[model samples]
Target chain A: MTLKGILLSASMIALAGAASAETRIGMITTLSGGGASLGIDVRDGFLLALEQAGRDDIEIIVEDDEQAPDVAVQLADRMIQAEDVDIMTGIIWSNLAMAVVPSVTAQGVFYLSPNAGPSQLAGRGCNQNYFNVAWQNDNLHEAAGAYANSAGYTNSFILAPNYPAGQDALAGYKRFYEGGLAGELYTQLGQTDYAAEIAQIRASGADSVFFFLPGGMGISFLRQYADSGLDIPVIGPAFSFDQNILQAVGADALGVVNTSQWSPDLDNAANTAFVAAFREAYGRIPSLYASQGFDTANLILSALAVADPSDEPDAFREALRAADFASTRGDFAFGPNHHPIQDIYVREVVQEGDIFTNRIIGTALEDRGDAYAAECQM
Target chain B: MSAILIVEQVLNGLQFGVMLFLMAAGLTLIFGVMGLINLAHGSLYMVGAFVAATVAGLTGSFLLALAAAMAAAAMAGAVIEMTVIRRLYHTDHLDQVLATFALILIFSEGTRAIFGSFPLYLDAPALLSGPVTLPLGIEYPRYRLALIAAGLLVALGLWLLIAKTRIGIQIRAGKNDREMIAALGVDIRTLYTFVFALGAALAGLAGALVGAIQSVQVGMGEPVLILAFVVIVIGGIGSIKGAFVGALIVGLTDTLGGIFLPEFFKLFMEPASATQIGASLSSMAIYLLMAAVLIWRPTGLYGVRA
Candidate 1:
């Protein structure tokens, strides 16, 4: 064939590729506010997996939500109606996820949630089009409660920010906890001052504290709690003690146990490789957010390899349910509601020279699925 | 609550109030004298905190950090006022708000570029880390007590500076009439810079001092800024005396309400609902106080007719 004929055939293949071969993903997450590091880690991890996979057919579009629900909604609309992305994911906060997920998934776009899996989406509100690789919002906190019960903590003072996720966290703790509550406090979301809360805790004489104040709020609380010298063991979910903010929590973070499904040293092949490769690429230890991002992206890739999700929805959904990819967490399966059903472990913040990261102390809940899965009709 | 607990809470309120005063003192002064509504004041507070943390991290000295916080913030203020704010003096409030809001984005992004997204460490010095046991077995964090004492001392010094000094008189006169002060050959531009720098230093001092207890991170100043605005509004926009009294009122009201309201509700309702109602009400308590004050005295507690 002549050169012109070959060019004509290449253009035909390219046109064919646009309709059938390519996978377009739109990620909307907080990237420019107090919670930016979480989204940044997720983006980096997802991209790293794509790089490792070396897939030419995948295209990613990223946008910053700045932790605002309206912005997330707008971004989702543009992605779905205008950009016509096949898959949407990477929402960091539950509020934003709630705002973006229902509408996007309603339009028949598959949403592979990387970070947030709000309780609303896990139960009666669960959509067949949405799959959360991350645990349901309450899984880790529920595990924390179970850990506290087994660890002989009778009187626990629990605290969380006053938001949907926070409310879910407190409820989750209460579900598994057989302990007597000394106090249950709901603080302002994004509050940095924990002095008054510490004073109350100290005076209450609670045996332990279980708080779910993540990001800067967690750092503030832990630092103040350490300085107050209350001598109470502090336990929480992994968000408060993740590697992203551990160094800032500094000496205070040591010995505080937080529950998570994944850690830097999970002793699995995929996890070990992900950690090493992430450190090599980003020059820092990967957090749980990063792990979730990698897993979510890999889940998409795995499903796409098995079947074109956009072309055949049922086949893609089944492939996703199969859980074909190697997860950073060693063993993983999707629960009935498309959320992760795996082990959640308690990790203690430990120091390795100047570096700080979490080390798995013990398992909190094994082979566990979310409580809301049974409530889902789907 | 026990009497001892009540006493500790009062102290907590005072401590919180004093911190607010430090932030509001600068805000009120800049507003009263310069007639400029600056949304970027929080950015200055953040600047002071980042500088203090950075310096404290390097030198291992809290004193140096405090000094550096004031210096850096004042310098930032001086530079900003001379370059960007001076031109906006005649502009309406909306322009100032938009400009300052943009400045917040710049400061936050610039700080992120330099510090990464992680919070910085600036612990209280060893000398102030332990708790102070008072009589009646009430143990309080010594650093907080010290913070209260320092805040009171600054309040006294501020009173002295405003009441007895020539610069204070000139500032008062300028607030009343900027054109007259300029015509009188008082170097109004320089004075404006000095006032702005002074306010910036105060904000920075608050940030540095508070940074020890709180996590020093990007956008740390924004929350404090909102509370400080409440202080100025209640204290009268330009009145330092008003700010001090207003700060104490706002501070005490916020802290005590947070502790007691929930307990009060717990007496009447189920524990969970009581906590929920109590938390929500306490958050709104300050705004309610502000509203009541406005209804009673429209100009605020110390506000005067312009």
Candidate 2:
């Protein structure tokens, strides 16, 4: 045997193999480049949950996916092969999740997703080992559509990058939006300059604009849109104006409405404690990604408490299905497809002191379920 | 589209073209004068943006931010030329490309280390934030109009400098016969540094100006850099006038093609499929234009005979 392998075996035997009994959880999330802040929030939230639960027996390994599906797949393989983790979770992008989940779950490791519930996973591709503690990708956009309806906008300019998630965003919005679209443009992925798009929107006579350009793209679009002097009211999913990016967007994002499955102001004991504790610990308000991470950790912890997943696989799956934990978003439960069925809230960006933050204006969709869930035989 | 709408879209295209000229001017100059391929030019553009954002945050003056961007990028370019770029002068194009590519990673990571991963904010001045009515009753942002004016003025100034000044004569001589210029009592090394820094400063100026309206983040320059490369190729590598014409062509083609192509296709095909094809084609329009230009004139539209 190699010296390193022999030493590892020696160490493994010396600890009475308490490590063998411990439930190792592998978290693969985007933690660098454009989506770094979102991944950092998820990691911090997950760690905070583990800290709060004060679990000594659960071991966690974190890896950054760098927003690349190939990287995520490689990390998942290492986690399952080398670390022998019982559960793998914490992917933020739907594309990466779609790549990593299918193969990882086939190997018998419980795959709990903190975010990114793609439509494919909700339907025919759904696995017994997979559980999504987040809403389907289209849920928030659908809520934005419902908000557009209630806000009484008759003509809207809609645009998203031409990708699967981007297509889902527009389709989700159109499902509920009663208004005629003045313009429906699919921009290049990672398009920064929006002057042409904005110019077209101006002439299209749209009373409102709904876009789904997330992260740096959203910041660039909003800044240019604001500069273009088009005073149309803008709406989008929460990913467009999240806490991570609001600082960069500045006043351009103010008064903009977005939809989310959870907000910091939910008026629940668990949520209040989470928001306060998260701020106290991290010196910033928790984002929606953070809430998802926190819930995913607690969900796994509850299952760990009931039965050791390594020893009692069936009972462990049953316990995870029970979802016996209070979520920061209040009462949360797993649907038959193992995705969260919960209320999505509409939030408005407002100046909170020197920093920009969101306020829960109203609820848009209550107990909304995925359209793809019916196709899942599970 | 309404006549006014058409005019406005055209104006938008002009604005985009002008900004691209600012970036491509420097790139073409460096390539012509030094025969060096700089992949890190984008990183320099990003440097200008980050420096501008930091300074604007501290000073709250857009003008100061612009000045700082120029100085910072120039200084950085000088340092990079002296330390790393000068050594690569004797090396082939492949070596220079690989070295500059490494610099991009270094610059991006180093900027991220200082600025953090989050984007920085730089606001347009209050005076230029609002819209103004032009002679044609077309309302446009005063800032964007001012950008077009500034870009044109710089182009004019560059034209005068190259055609009328001592440094311009030296620069042209260096591009024509570097060894001859060096042997003729000119400090060719210093001249190359000056040229690189001038290019970097122009890119920085573009970055600082656009950062006011766009997100100031790491890797912001790459998209513009790629477009600038296409501009240089289309214009003719060593020609400033070519860069200007090429930048405008690319800018207009990108902007106008994005708008009208889909509508044109929608006349015959399903709107959904039309948009798909239009977007795909428009995104590829400039490259296709570049390829066509090359097919007609292999070196470029304004390429000088070797």
Candidate 3:
């Protein structure tokens, strides 16, 4: 072969090698069906942060889990084994997160959670390989419980779907509230009707009601709760009445109270920029799911800034635990179990002109951990 | 439970029953008349909801949006019946199931392509927005009571249309003996189209009504569809009266079981364990009822054994 032709082939090989050296992160989330709105918010938030970074040195592989735990595990396996993703992130459901965490962590790869910190992982099952950029499973609900106690809402009722997360939420609320319990109703998960429960709530004569019905369940319950004409005030965590739900409930959610770690109305430079950039890109305010996704990506990027991008798995794992992300929550530190320590806020749904958004009424809590954390060995 | 609470729960159960009837009536009619198990029926329901939501957003009139949704779904139903479902009529149930399952994928992806993977909302009309006090001093949402009344009216209207009309006789005949009716000079193909369209319209109506209460998005029909299937299986595959009875039973069992079962379990188990066990069992109660009914009578409660 001629020297000229050999040189040309060598240059083509060199360019391809340069392109393959970029850091790749795999993001799996629900992007279809009922949960699509929240998933879109998460995807947009992560992409926005990546765009702002303006680094061609990183690539994102986005997969839709379709809200199924089996599909999530399959996608995680494919992303790790076939695509060779350097880092894994983005899951909405706690069960789906639980399904994939074991495999991802056992592979000795970094797994950052944008959402869904189940209590088991926050406590006894905690792993150094898993880092949650979101609040613990019970943190927001505990804040609501604290607020309920302060408001003197004794004789309150609790309702939640029957699931691990639901149980954790109720346990979290009862932890802080030293009130007379009226009743607790555990309904089937994915139940669309709330009439019987509403009747029971009214019958119990609870002064207030606290519930944790996330996703479509929340929409169904809040609408029916308003329709039932029960005079008691309804309260829940942000997952039950956030932006995704506001689109469905509209003015029906007016005056309902909730608690969360992140709100779009949070008055901070980091949060303001995050909200503005997200709204510009997605034409809607980011939900907590989105904030968590953006934060997880930022966390990974910050760790990369500290450790060499080309470092081995041991170096990358050390860098991640160092806690270096410029978080929108303003001052987040990881606890021993790798879950975040952050403040939680009590927010009320009120109208700003024609649009409805969560207004921060008070900061009911700060720097809280899951109730089971004292048992955590990690 | 207090008398007021019990009264409220019963009403709630009735409202839920009515909604289930709307969904089950369509599914049963299609199954009985066409002898085809179209799993993608739920996708049509989702389409109706999305169309209603988009129309409501654009026009801001709930009535107009509801009308448009029903019409759009019926039109889509007719077109699909002609182009796709018509070809599957003579095929086996397995083939029909597989083909319709594929249609679900197409419809879902197509919807995502258009709607961009976000939920759309529909608002209740102002006329039915607030609560109304009943004679017993109980306040229920005017819309829900209206829904219960409307559902009953539809059921009555359907009964009259099916029992007292010429088309009703033809449909009953079609369900019983397809070949004999076809030999007697009636246009069987046209009749099938009409039956499918009627079922699709009912499913669409259910979707539009429920859209006001729930978010409209892809796969919204799935849960309702499953419940409807349970309704038909319990009520009998081909009987509207059975659908009504089955819907009420399923609804009450679901709603009441969820509440009372946990309390019952609490007598024996701790609150947390009772909740976990009771909630799981309550969700399974209707299915258990269905299994017992089927085992006792090989056909459903009202089904005519083939």
Candidate 4:
């Protein structure tokens, strides 16, 4: 054989390998109707981070869920079967996340969560292929519970909708709080009125009230809470007090306390730059969900840098576990169970001129894991 | 539960009932008068909310936005009735249901196309912003109280319009015998248009009022519409008084059951199991109540025999 022929054949083989080695990630998140604002923010944040990194070898297949669990499952299945996604990520609700994660991971594909780490996954059910770039389901609420305990509230009433997430939230609160619970009320999921619960709380004579009502339920509860004229402090997790509810509740949410792992006002170079870029691009303040999504994309990008693009699943999973990437929350590390161990802060809703925003008042805990971590074999 | 709490819950239930009545009243009127089951009624509610939010954003006046919402919903109702609903009057129930379901899809997609799929919000006016003290040291939201009062006033107004006025008599006559009324030279088509418009206006008002307390967005009205259907079915198919009563019972049972069921279960079961079972049962309480009511009174409380 001639040397010229050998060199031409080698070049042809290299070109074919490069084309097949392209890495692809599938993103499924709520992106239409009521949940669209949050979904759009997450999508934009992820894409922006990807663009800034300037890596064309990685491709993303983003699908809108419309906040339906069944649709989320279908989209995840499609991404795996048809698109042949190497990794799956981005789900906003714990219920939807729970539904999709089992299937994605069962197929031996890596599933990374930008948001929604349900307590079950953080505890006994933790899996090696699943990683949460966001905090555990209970971490933020545990912070709120810790804050409430510190405030000397001996008897507190609690309310949440009756769902797995809701039950987990109450359990999360009880994990940190060592006090007498005056009453615990679980209402129907998506309930619109709080009058009966308000009456019960008033009668219970609790020192304070802690709630875990997210989405539209949060708006309704906050409005009714204000209407009931209860002077007791109202505390909740960040999901109920974020920008989505802030816009609906407005002045009514003023002085309400909440706990979160990430806030727009966090002091860090990455976060400051992120907030500015997000506001410039979207014309709105980015929520923690957006920040987490941005971080997840960066995490995957960093892992891609370590693993050979042609490396198989096991190699990619190891690279992801290392997770050496810049995050808006600053210096975050994943626990053995693949959930983030991060700082949680207590924030109060305050009016900044005409706009309402959360202001950090105290740090409840730093680098915490779920209480059920002891039970997790992983 | 203490007396005060029970009273408060009842009031809450009544408030919820009244809101359902507003929705159910329109639904029942349309069904009784036209023999049509319009599933797109919820879309009209969403339209009212969207319109109110947009106008309020532009004008910065809640009252004017509310007025505009009513007018816009009425116009929308009239247009839908003339163009789409008129074609379905002679059709069967299944076809009517399917067409209105299609209208829901069209309305939702069209709304998203115009509003860009994000939720729009409406703020409560300053006057009704704070909590007001009611009799017996019960502090309640002024806006909610206002809603209850408005609902009662609407109920009275509807009664007077349907019972005392000439249009009311014509409507009653029309409902009793549409062909006979048509034979008597009544413009049945115009009367049908007016009835549909009136129903739409009520639904619009409910949407605008509720939007202040919840996020206004596409598909927002669907859940409430389902409850309204349950209300009318339990109250009686064609009876307004039945709708009112059924709304109250359903609302109170749902709210109170959610709160008390877990506690009740805790008496016999472990806390965790009780919570799981209780939550599930609370969601089903109203449906169970409706079933029991049906077993006893199949035609509903105020339903007249056909």
Best candidate, DockQ-wise?
3
Give Cα distance to truth, residue A165, candidate 3, Å: 2.3
- How would you encode candidate 4's per-residue C-alpha lDDT over B1-306 as one tens digit per residue? 566676677777777878888888889889878988989999888888899999999998999988988898888999999999999999999999999999999989999899987777787787887778778887777887888898888888988998899999888887889999999999999999999999898899888888887778889889988988888889988777788788888978876776688779999999878967887898889889888888889988777754
**Per-residue lDDT over A45-157 for candidate 1, one digit per residue giving the tens place of the 0 to 100 score:** 88788778877677677788878899999989987776678899999888888888999889999998998888999999999989999899899999999999989999999
Give the TM-score ranking, best first: 2, 1, 3, 4
The CA lDDT at A210 in model 1 is 93
Candidate 1 chain B weakest lDDT stretch, 10 residues: B1-10
Provide the overall lDDT of each model, using Cα atoms, as 2-decimal numbers: 0.88, 0.86, 0.81, 0.82
The C-alpha TM-scores of every prediction are 0.93, 0.94, 0.92, 0.92
What interface RMSD does every candidate have? Answer: 2.0, 1.9, 2.1, 2.4
- Report the number of clashing residue pairs per model: 0, 0, 0, 0
- RMSD of each predicted structure: 4.9, 4.3, 5.2, 6.1
Regions of model 2 farther than 4 Å from truth: A1-21, A250-252, A351-355
List the candidate 4 regions with Cα displacement exceeding 4 Å.
A1-21, A308-310, A351-353, A374-378, B259-279
Cα lDDT of model 3 by residue, B169-256, tens digit: 8888888999999999889899888877877777787788888877788877878888899889998998888898899899888877
Q: Which ten residues in a row have the lowest lDDT in candidate 4 chain A?
A: A1-10
Which runs in model 1 stand beyond 4 Å of their true positions?
Answer: A1-21
What are the per-model DockQ values? 0.49, 0.52, 0.61, 0.57
Candidate 2 lDDT, tens digit per residue, A1-378? 322333344345333322554778888987776667778888888888888886656667777787888999998988787778889999988888988999988999999988788888988999888999978888899999999999999998999887667877898899899999998988866677788888888889999999998776888788778777789899999889888778877777888899998887778999999999999887898988899999999999888889988789889999999999999988788889888888999999999888898889999988888878899986
Q: How well is each residue in B1-306 modelled by candidate 1, as lDDT tens digits?
A: 667668878888999999999999999999999989989999999998999999998999999999999999999999999989998999999999998898898999999899877677688999999688888888788999999999999999988888899998899999999999899999999999999999999999999999888778888898889999999999989999999999999999998998899999989899878877887899999999999998888888899954
Candidate 1 DockQ vs. native: 0.49
Q: Deviation in angstroms for A157 in model 1?
A: 0.6
